[model samples]
Target: MSTGKGPVGIITGALSGIGAATALEFARLGASLILADIETQSGDEMITKAAELGGTATVAECDVTDYAAVERLVARTTADLGRLDFLVANAGIAEQSRIASGDPARWARVVQTNLLGTMHCVRAALPVMRRQGEGHVLIVGSTSGREPYVGEPSYLASKYGVVGFAYALRMECAEYGVRATVVEPGTVDTPLTRRPPAVRALLEQMHPLAPEDVARALVFTYQQPPHVVISELVIRPLDEAVNADMPDAEPR
Candidate 1:
């Protein structure tokens, strides 16, 4: 697959961070990619960069929170690229406020984008993959899902919801020859992680996992043989303090 035009896949939130890093890694393997995001300028820029790396890529302005937009993104990929081999549901947001005093609106955004957004991408793409008799769905989750932490009520809830959804999805897609895998990563240096000052300090103090680190793991999971189903993967920095100090921190 790396020798020529590779797997046809769509990556939500492909403009930056882990999403962008993943896109470039896939490009190095010569994959055909649909860089999906709400941003157009960065999408265009990523397309150029992917082509420079010898991958065929295009941009789709998609809001994963909107099911209709997600459906259209899947449709466009199949219509324009011939088939959908994989779906990377990586679009997400982070929140750092306590539920008792936090903005409900922000909480809603976190849940909608992190959890519902993943569901939208999977729902829109799974049917196409089922018809194809082969496909992969890789969701970018977080360490927050695996354990409870302070100051990240909604974000953790959403990720935990995603972990549940991925396992159930794996069962449903098993008979259809489609695979579902959720990658949970610890702190990563990304735009999303840098949003809040407290999280930013935590990020700066430690040697957190880079976006490319998570991206490589994602590609390896997808590149596995058809029969191999890597149900779940969790990656964290070697430093135990990352978890001990800021347990609520996550990767986007």
Candidate 2:
């Protein structure tokens, strides 16, 4: 920890995209952070940047898809920081193919990273939070979770699971002073979204939400009074019409 004076937090997938943005945002708040991800170089870069922003941070090389790895990351955070105040289950992957032609292997990776990965992080953190009698868990879901679309079948399934998982986790942990929030962002301009050529083409026409936009929402949700929980937050770009068409469908 860089000795910053704020609650300690662990952000999964903290090296890039929305996760990176969220880490930077929290750093601006002087929060202590465990930037968890599989990318070491990016993590180091983020740590240096975080220090520049007046935040204390360290990188934890973690593969969120592995339950044991996630458990260890949670344990390590509390040991090094002395307390665990918040966790952002933000690690995820996306596939652009439809169910009929999509590779099952890719779909499996998507579910493991997006859905089970969230579950592992939350489950490991809950006990720690309950012991302290306070904590917050923020799961980054996609707008795809709430609506149907032509493509991205696996991604949709995973995110939908995330939404339900967050709600159920909220109910289970609220009494213990732990909070769970699901953040669903519509179209965001991130590497994941830009990877698909079709989505990249659409990005040229509309001003999609930036990664920082969703990061701000996460910070806002996390900074709320402990007693108040913003259960769900859905954000989309103004030009991203609701229930539009395949790919741009529903700001997902």
**Candidate achieving the largest lDDT:** 2
Query: Where in model 2 is the C-alpha error above 4 Å?
Result: 2-4, 248-252
RMSD of each: 3.4, 2.7
lDDT of 2 by residue, 60-149 (tens): 899988889999998888888888999999999988776666789999999999999999999898899999999999999989999867
Clashes (N, CA, C under 3 Å) per candidate: 0, 1
lDDT of each: 0.88, 0.89
Q: How does each model score on TM-score?
A: 0.94, 0.95
Which digits, one per residue and each the tens of the lDDT, describe model 1 over residues 1-252?
222458899999999999999999999888899999888787778878998988978888888889998998899888878899989999998878765678899999999999999999999999999999999999999888987767888888999999999989999999989999999999889998888777787777788999999999999999899999899999998873544635333333
Model 2: ten consecutive residues of lowest lDDT? 243-252
Which residue pairs collide, candidate 1?
A: none
